[model samples]
Structure formats: C-alpha cells, structure tokens
Target: MNYGMVFLSIISNRFFDLLDVLNKLNELKLFTLFINIKEILLDLRIPKSKQMRTLEQWFEEYAVSHQNPKNKAIHYVCVPAIFFSIVGLLMSIPSGFIANTLKLNAPIIENWAVVVLLFVLVFYIRLSVAMAIKIAIFSAICLVANYYIGQVFPLWIFSIGVFVIAWIGQFYGHNIEGKKPSFLKDLQFLMIGPAWVVENLFSKK
Candidate 1:
C-alpha cells in the first residue's frame, strides 16, 4: 500500500463529500438562506457593494413614472423651465434689504437666487459632486437668463407665468405616465428629478 496516495485519496473523498452536501443544499435553496441566517445570528459583516450600487439605482427607479417617451421629453423641457422660472422669480424679489444689511452689494449675481442656489447646492452635493457642479453651471445660465428676462419684461410676472405653465406641463406629463410625481411621496425626489435629468447626459458606466 502506498501511504501518500492513500492519504491523497482520503482528502479527495472528503472534498467531494463537502461539495455534494453544498450541492444538495443549493438544490433545496437553503444554502444561501442558511448563510444569511448564520450571518444574522452571529452578527457577521456582509459586504456592501450590492447596496452601494443600488443607491445609484434609486435615481432611475424613483423616476420610473417619467420613463414614458412623451413624459420624459416633456420633463427635458419643463424641468429646466420650472427651475429657471423659480430662480427668476426669486431673483426678482428684492433681497436688496438683506444685501444692504450684509453689505453684499455686488449688484449682479448676488441676490435671492444666489442665496437659494447656495442652499439648494448643499442638497445636491450630498447626493453627488458631479451633479452639484452641473446644477451650479445650470444656475449660472439661469442667472444670465434672469437678467435678460428682467431687461425685456417684468421679471416677476414673466417668471410666475412660466412657473405656472411649466408645472401644468409637468402634471400633464404625469397624466400621460398614469402615475403621480415622486415628490408627492417624498420631497427629496424633487431634487432627485433634476439629477435624473442631468445624469441622462452621461453613460451608465
């Protein structure tokens, strides 16, 4: 009898036996369940890559109702419209008193819109840095547009009119989608809506 070959055969048999038991457990669908239970009972740490990926997935999932082609197209136009209208409306408001008090009188681009955009960017930055930067650039364009809109027309009146019309388009889009807006469930989705729109310009990878 060759002792080394005998020991190797014994080890191979034990390995095959373990694999057989695992295969049987897998057929019963208990292998994963048992491991999960074991982890829970033992308070073991499970890796979190799946959850990390799902966090990004929430943006697309939350925007599911807007997936309809017409609805999405409408959002592409209306979300920015509603956003810039609000910014214009706010910029039209006289923050001159606050500016005077704080001595922040830069005369252009330092107004209620700038103040509000600062706070809004905080919310976006917490979600994604790239998104926050995109929003800032968008806000800058809106500021310039606000100046132009104010130059050509009554800023508040024009902004309010656009705001109302843009929102009407939004509800109409949702009507086409056969679902309510996600912001109705949680207002954070209001911010996520813009992020979803901006992120579409980039690839999934």
Candidate 2:
C-alpha cells in the first residue's frame, strides 16, 4: 500500500484499539453491548459482500486454529486494545500539553476540532451509520479525556515522548507476532481491526 494509506491504517488501527480497551474497562459486563454497537458500525460502513463473507470465514478458521476460545477472544481484544491505548495515551499527552502551553483560550473549540477530524477519518474509511455513531461516542469520550489531560500536562514534551514510547510498544507487539502488520496490505484493514476484535468476542456466544 501507499505510504499515506499505511499511515492512515496505522493511526486508525491504533485509535479503534484504544476505544476497544476503554470500552472494555468501562463496561466489562456489557461486552455484548459493545458487539451490538459494533454491528451498528458495520451497518453504516456497508462492507463488500465478498469481503464480509471472507472475513467471517477467516475469523472462524482463526478461532478454530487457536484451539482455545478464550485465548482467541483475548488475542482479538487485547492486542489491538493495548496497541491503540498506548498510541492514544501517547498522542494525547503531547496534544494536551501543547494546548496548555499555547494557552489555547478555547479548549472546547479545540476539542470540537478533534471530534470533527475523527468524523472525517471515519468517513474516509466509509464506516456505516452504526459504526459512525459508535466512533462519535468514543471521540466524545476521548475529547473529555484530552481536555482533562491537557489541563494537567505540557503539550510538546508530552506529545513527542508519548509518540516515541507508544511506537516502541507497537513494534514490540509486531515483533512477537513475526508477521508484517495487516494494514500493510489494505488500508481498510485498519478500520477492520476493531470490528474484528468485537466479532471474535461475539462469536463465542
């Protein structure tokens, strides 16, 4: 894939993964709820029929190949969740710090900008209405988190440091897997990462 596509995949994968972890932590008992939320997301995106069937078959095979339902589910959820959480946490630190240092008089406006950017990103990925709504909810949560974190930290230092650290963690995860990352093949795979995890979770039921 092109460099821009790769970059988008990387960022999108990381973002959705972060949302997965945050959602999990916030509502462990409501895992199925998240699955329903994901279904809504899928509805909005309108994935290709052939690709959808292929993905479903691939996931079923993947689940069986692992031989442990729990492990499979954990793999689906934890890998992306941890990878993306680090990314989000890293990026947010710097963003938060920068806004603080600049004395951005209108934090709300900045947060709205971030939300709008997220919507654009999701749109670019061609997410469905349901998926868009889920992402909007996550973006809203991230904004609140960003505002609070910005109030507490210095932006430039936080941004650079977080980027470095999170990237290292990401590479480490890939190293263990010993495979070129999925986004390298298809940029849309980035959006699929979160839905894939949610699919695995629901597949168990």
Candidate 3:
C-alpha cells in the first residue's frame, strides 16, 4: 500500500535489468565496452577536486619558489625566452619523416614543434581551458618568430644560445630568492612555469 515501496521496486527492477544487459555485453566479448561504460560512470561519481589539481593550485605551488622580487622579475623575462627558444629548437628539427608517416599535407601543421605543442596544449587543457588557450596563443607567436628566424639564421644554434643564457639568469634569480626552481621537485612544473607567466601577464589579479 506504500507509494514509496512501489517506487523502490520499480527502481530496483530497472537497476537489475541494466546490470543484466552489462553482463550480456561482457559475455559477448565486448568486455572492453562494458569496462569503458563502468569507468565513465565511476568518473562521473568522483568529485572534481579529487580528479586533478586546479590551475590556481599549480600557480600557488610555483609561486612558492619564485617569491623574491628579483626572482619574480627574472622569471617574467626568462620564462618566455626559454619557452620561445625551446619552440625554435623543436621547429629546427626536420619533420619530413613525421609528415610522410602521418600522410599529412598541411604545411602549417607539419612541424615537429606543432606536433609537440599539441601534446603540451593537452596538458594545459587538463589544468584549465583558459590556460590552454593562453598557452596556445603564445605558442603560435613563438612558431611565427622561429619561422622568420629560421629563414635568416640557424634556429637550433640561436635556441641553444638563448637556452643556456636564460638558464643562467634563472639560476641567478633563484639564488636571490633563496629557493630552488619548482621543477626540481616535479618535472610537470616545467610546463606550469609558462602557464604561470602567461597568467601574470594577462590576469588583472
């Protein structure tokens, strides 16, 4: 006679029916399909905070080692320079093999740097979409600059020169800060450094 009992019975029946369907899927050698669906449901049940670190959290940790004004100022300059140089170095690598292997015809997306940056963008996206977009814009600019520089000079040599000098400056700044670079603790902070720099440049806060 209870309405609540009727509702519970209906829900239980539907739940069991769904489980039976899932079991059939597994028996049919579609175990992967069942596992993927299970994983998706589990992922949805997990809270966002438990899934990944937020952009603010990454920046907060990065800021710990970059506290001193000298360190902060140096980072403002050196981070972008280091990022640019790495991109230039990547672009200098021949992409003919990658292009041939992938059967790609697009000139714009054929460079090694572009291929690498796509993965980098994925990392940024996992932290924050806004961060991803910002890094993408900066990466495009680096690509353009490297393109022009490669036309007139050896990009690999230029990148190596800038990379060495920038690291020297970075170490000096960290010495002034009296803290080690954040990447020493975890290599992921290497990617975080550029995001932190971009946030500082664009964010009013």
Q: Cα deviation in Å at residue 109, candidate 1?
A: 2.0
Q: Native-vs-model 3 lDDT?
A: 0.88
**lDDT per residue, candidate 1, 27-78, as tens digits?**
9999788888987976644335423434277576676777899999898888
Best by lDDT: 3
- Encode model 2's per-residue lDDT on 60-122: one tens digit a residue: 433333444444444554555443343345444324654666677656444334644465456
Each candidate's TM vs. the true structure? 0.69, 0.44, 0.72
lDDT for position 74 in model 2: 42
Error of 1 at 60 (Å): 2.5
The 0-to-1 C-alpha lDDT of every candidate, in the order given, reads 0.82, 0.54, 0.88
Task: Report clashes for each candidate as comma-separated counts.
Answer: 0, 13, 0
Overlapping backbone residue pairs in candidate 3 total 0
> Residue by residue across 1-205, what tens digits does model 3's lDDT show?
8999999999999999999998888789798877889999987684656347888998998999988888999999999999999998888888898888778685456789998999999988988998899899999999988888988899899999999999999999999998889999878799999989888878887
Write down the worst ten-residue block by lDDT for model 3.
Answer: 43-52
Q: Which is better, 1 or 2, measured by TM-score?
A: 1
Query: Which pairs of residues collide in model 1?
Result: none
